[model samples]
Target: MGSSEFQSPRVIKAAGLPYFTPANNGGAALNPEDPSTPTLFRPLTIRDVTLKNRIMVAPMCTYSTNPDPSSPAIGALNDFHIAHLGHLASKGVGLVIIEATAVQPNGRISPNDSGLWQEGTDSEQFKGLQRVVNFIHSQGAKAGIQLGHAGRKASAVAPWLSWEGKKGSIRADESVGGWPSNVVGPAGGEEQKWAPGNVKYWAPRELSTSEVEEIVQAFARSAKLAVQAGVDVIEIHGAHGYLVHQFLSPVTNHRTDKYGGSFKNRIRIVQEITATIRAVIPDGTPLFLRISATEWLEGNPVAEKTGSWTMDSSTELAKLLPEFGVDFLDVSSGGNHRDQKVEPHGNYQIDLAGQLRKVIQQAGQKTLVGAVGLITEAEAAGQIVQGADEAVATEELLAGQEPKADAVLLARQFLREPEWVLTAARKLNVPISLPVQFARGLL
Candidate 1:
């Protein structure tokens, strides 16, 4: 992926921290009228969306525990989600992804996750989401939602809580009265039970074809809700061993039907779901997806052999998704299985992303792409964007402090510091610095 190298900008100090001198290739570069001057600070536009800068806030669950309104924080749903998302808006990220929300009550990873399942779910449970989007718009940032369904992994204990919970416990096919699969359809009438998990993650009852269709409809319903909630983008979560991931992985989906045998079939559900949602969302509002390029462990349902959602799969998916109207690809891996093969460095999965871009670019595909692993240093992030062998779409790198990617996306960083974009702008010495109202309180 090495070809063009960025002209490193001279670093300067502003507000007591080192800042990058805006360059032709700096985070925000504008094209020069003169041929001799390189383009610098150009506005980034995706579909009908244009961002002031490439920086974005990645979706993250604070595990705020707003599950029961009758509980201590029962009525705090709107307040919690609004404050959580509003903080990112205040920070000035170009894009802010609200946490992964479930499309159905049973699809949620935990009872606490934000959702848009029913008609009133958003109106009541997520009035906060709209307020957050309004806040982001006020700050010139586009708001997106990461819609997800935890399949076999559903109904499990949250990390913060004790590992033992009766609510999320599932049942296996062999244990006692057999697995009672609970899906929207009534195919598995014999056993009306939940899925079972041998390990910590839940192993949901294998869904029937009819049930899968119901799940697909649920996603479409959620998309309509998102549109009603005023979201600017809709990102489907097909990664990290969720319901869609379960169907995509060979280990999890052993079905002998059209949705299982081949890589294309396994990914059919996710692909169709994307298309279904895309059809309903406002035209031109960019559609993006996050996928676990590979699952980590053995016997794990999400693992791949060679043809499935690997880098090759990603490239193919990237190329094909655009036909259905997707705008970008968020690359991630290792949730299908627990024991994944990884280098554990700053840019290990970068090769996967870069390789995917190479394939897509070589094929002359027009889909935008992004990376979201250990991207911390600005220089390294810039290198990937500059040197991508193919027409590499856009690069998105995220790290702890959140400024290393072509466009940084962060979860923990935003949770810790909602105004991180402001911090980044000041740290990088951008002209559109944080509003003066926050200047006094920033320090």
Candidate 2:
């Protein structure tokens, strides 16, 4: 279908339910005196795609895909992905970023993780992904897909199946339906053990220089395919101890080559991939890079000596991301190491996002920062977007002053409430477009 076809009245009606005005439409001006005009409902424009609201569905792995034991073409989207993502799209979300999709076969987090490397528009998998993007566009929500390689974290059984034998322990499944033993990372010959249950963990072989280059190309190729699949945004999964994060973090990257050791070297891989993908995708297509703002291993007495990834390094990286053409930074925390400490507080990683945002702004770059982690309440979500009290708290924690991120990404909360965006709109009393079928129900 042509690009103009997506704008047809029928498509628009099917995609965006009636009773909802396009948030970008020059509608009536919101009254300042109206408490319903919450900041969360304000539109956000990154490049050519403008989000109808500040709320974005963060990429959360579902491990639901078609896995072929004989084919590398496994990891194609099945009915689960379409129904799962399609449902979220119809809920009036501003943006919906699909979960971590592997760029290559071995890059998958499990045997069932979605992949786009081998799928094209002609393939069934590509069609499924395109169907998802169509559904999202129909709902007037910007669609995004996160491209990632799990690195050393790959080749593990799905989390649900992992609990069959051990609690919180991810064991390798050598069964016919399991992943192949081809996990690779920055460090080779050094075996890292898993905690939680003290399970023996075999280390991944270090990626050779040639292999590294191929991986970068793989990311570019996957991004190109994603764009062809109708994705409006491309998020590089550089966070949560993924392949790119492995290269960024000092704890995992101990290579003597140009891809490791110093800060510049550690970030080289991600920078290259970002640049490559930026070149491959169409101009104005927003590019987002998710980063583990802090590994959360620093400062702790048990972790202080490990010389782990820290906010300082992340700040430095955030400053250079714009140079590589990154439009947004999705700031997240931890997942680089098993022993990392996490405080069970709401908006736990907002401080890190605030810090990264400050650094990016101070560098005089246009790159937007997105805060995520435990942000569940509507009032708090509004405050973060408004850069008000809630934003002040995150800023104060980071630099004792300054504003917060430009946007916020919500994960588990969206899983808990697929209609959270609609719910938030109602709670904030903001005028939001809803499905015509549910319009009376809201009344």
Candidate 3:
């Protein structure tokens, strides 16, 4: 590609809205009426892919299905999934990451969680996912998928119903606000732990080094599959006390061997896994890792009260990850334990993101980082980036808040209202082009 063939800038000299800044070119002048400063809405390119805005949709869970809700959702192209994703794309998010889809049947957080566990290379569910990917692309938004394993967190009622899961508390069934009937965990044939995975949360035959190697291969294969399905980015789930999170903390991963007992060993699998995934995926495609920066687990026996996987450890991970070609760190906290100390409030994770950013910068690494968790106002989310762009969402930003997350990755919010972005633009008075199908009501 020659310089002459390059496309013109997407925005004019007029002020860019939001606060996140563009990497190149002076941002457009400010406009009080628009508040569309040249900052927050800037384009960002990770690796070889480019994003239209810093905001990205966080990987959210949407346990929707046709026929019945109790069954294992064979990823179908139902109207529900379309309307949900279509609205976000039309709203003009630069990138939208699909929710965490289980890599294997046993790895699912619940039966209804979307997955590619089947053997079909081009089956209906796979095709449906592709259609969603195509729709996102048609709307000029890059589609990404999060690869995950629920581990002990496997099996639970969808968030929509009144299901509360914490450590040591496992509801016997979905009868009394328990997890849905099908939601099961690692410990079966008994009452599953509601809070975290019930039972000892013990090492299941613990992934042998060979099995660990197989898991790594699975991640790489999944990344390849996501690309084949037209996903623009691939994210590994290392947060929320899922499979990767279990390895990060001493509590969940209690093996006396090389795979555990030390921070380096615990992080070893992820390090190798990322490298493996990157090697398989086309170079330049964006690759991200979502991490439980700090276990925040008070007495996590393994990592102890003071151990790695701390905010500082997260920074180190980011810096180290760049070698394996990680484009960004989705810095989210907790999940290493059922009772992680959550200092809940809007934008609470900002401090950790900020600190991690500094640590990465000091390490002389150039990889960018994104923050999630409780970002309410769009401006505040941008502020944490110092207006540098790149922010993700958890559950809160989807329900309330100003379109704050750079890419608001939603779970239930997306499921409840995929076209929530439509509401967001209208409520905020920001301009956007919603799909014609959804236009009737909005207009």
Candidate 4:
């Protein structure tokens, strides 16, 4: 295969033509008049990693592991993960990030979440993940993993199981190999059930200061394990009401210790985790941090009184992340507070990403931003990923406007269409790499 515009020499290269070909390659590069290519199909480089396109598959927990605690195979990857992630990579996605994996057993959102903390590279967790990462690399797509601790939301039943009959935050108690007694967070009590009534979530125990430090180490440890598994990137899952976000939001972190109170205190855990992970991973490896950006608690009477994690807070933190060695900020929102009022609609979080992107650009920071949420359809994605000059040259629109994000991430959309990149290339009238075996199908 010829050199890929998106491929970095540092990471492993797959044989055959690049899976997600760039329009700038020889065929299109020869035509100076051919400028119809969309930015969504363009490559994005962060540190040593370069993606073939701006479409990233957002981390979505599959909860496909064995639920039985007594089973040694619990919290390990298997055939399902390979088929799940491999199918996406083969279809031309530039980056395929694995789901929210736990840093420790107790940190899993469900009893079936994949986990790190195994002894060595020879461990089942390491071998399983390596197999999955190898497949992603073989398909010419960069692979990433989100290391997270579910915190107060731990030990819940999978969404599908809950939808069948149970509702709310249903727990997977001891009867099902889950440790309900171990459910913990920044502040502990019955009042902090996430959902107040009829929810199966147990009252969480507040993590002691020492326990908090240990969790930070767990993130770093998990990152080290990921590096060994040949993952191209490591993302700290600080978003959605997880452990790190639990500390970031004042609504949940009522701790009187050094970890709570002021903004600096509240952000301590995330800062520490970032520093530690950077210390462990190779310098060339990019570290991406996913953030809620906002808890969506604006204008609520309860939020007004108790204070909430708002856009202002996110902006303040975004500026400091680059200094902590974060190369990219994956902007997402909500899932922190129950009273958080959000009217989900088209481009609901795009504006927030745009606001945050402007702030980052104004500050002259190097951190790249990614927008994720209801971003379906190829044309809309192309516009969001650095607006097309020809498509938006009119004065009626924000003429010469910068894009809302450097890239657009999708969860449900990718789940619906694994070949989204190929479909997008076709829609935009651009050429992309197709699997050699599947070339006949396209013809």
Clashing pairs in 2: 15-138, 15-139, 16-138
C-alpha RMSD of each candidate structure in angstroms: 10.6, 5.3, 9.6, 5.3
Instruction: Give the better candidate number (1 or 2) by lDDT.
Output: 2
Error (Å) of candidate 4 at residue 208 is: 0.6
> Residues 213-288, candidate 2, lDDT per residue (tens digit)?
9999999999998899889999999988888988888788888888988888989998899889989899889999
What TM value does model 4 have? 0.90
Which 10-residue window in model 2 sums to the lowest lDDT?
A: 20-29
* TM-score ranking of the models: 4, 2, 1, 3
Model 3: worst 10 consecutive residues (lDDT sum):
21-30
Better of 3 and 4 by lDDT: 4
lDDT of 1 by residue, 20-109 (tens): 212111222233222221111124567788766665677886545466524433222365665677556656666788888878666666
CA-lDDT, candidates in order: 0.59, 0.76, 0.61, 0.82
User: Mind giving the per-residue lDDT tens digits that candidate 3 earns over 1-443?
Assistant: 76445334542221222232212211111231233533344567787897765667888777664223343335444567666775677656667888887776546665456776544556655776777777676666778888887765655445554344443323223342223333322223332232434432322334556666777787887777778878899999999878887777666666566667777887887888888888888987888889887877555554464353577667657778877678888878886555566777766776677677767766877767777776545445455433353244423334433222233333445445555445544554445544433446767
Order of all candidates by lDDT, from best down to worst? 4, 2, 3, 1
TM-score of each: 0.75, 0.87, 0.74, 0.90
- The most accurate candidate by TM-score is 4
Residue 187 of candidate 3: its Cα lDDT? 27
Candidate 2 vs 4: which has more lDDT: 4
How many backbone clashes does every candidate have? 18, 3, 33, 0
Whole-model alpha-carbon lDDT for candidate 3: 0.61
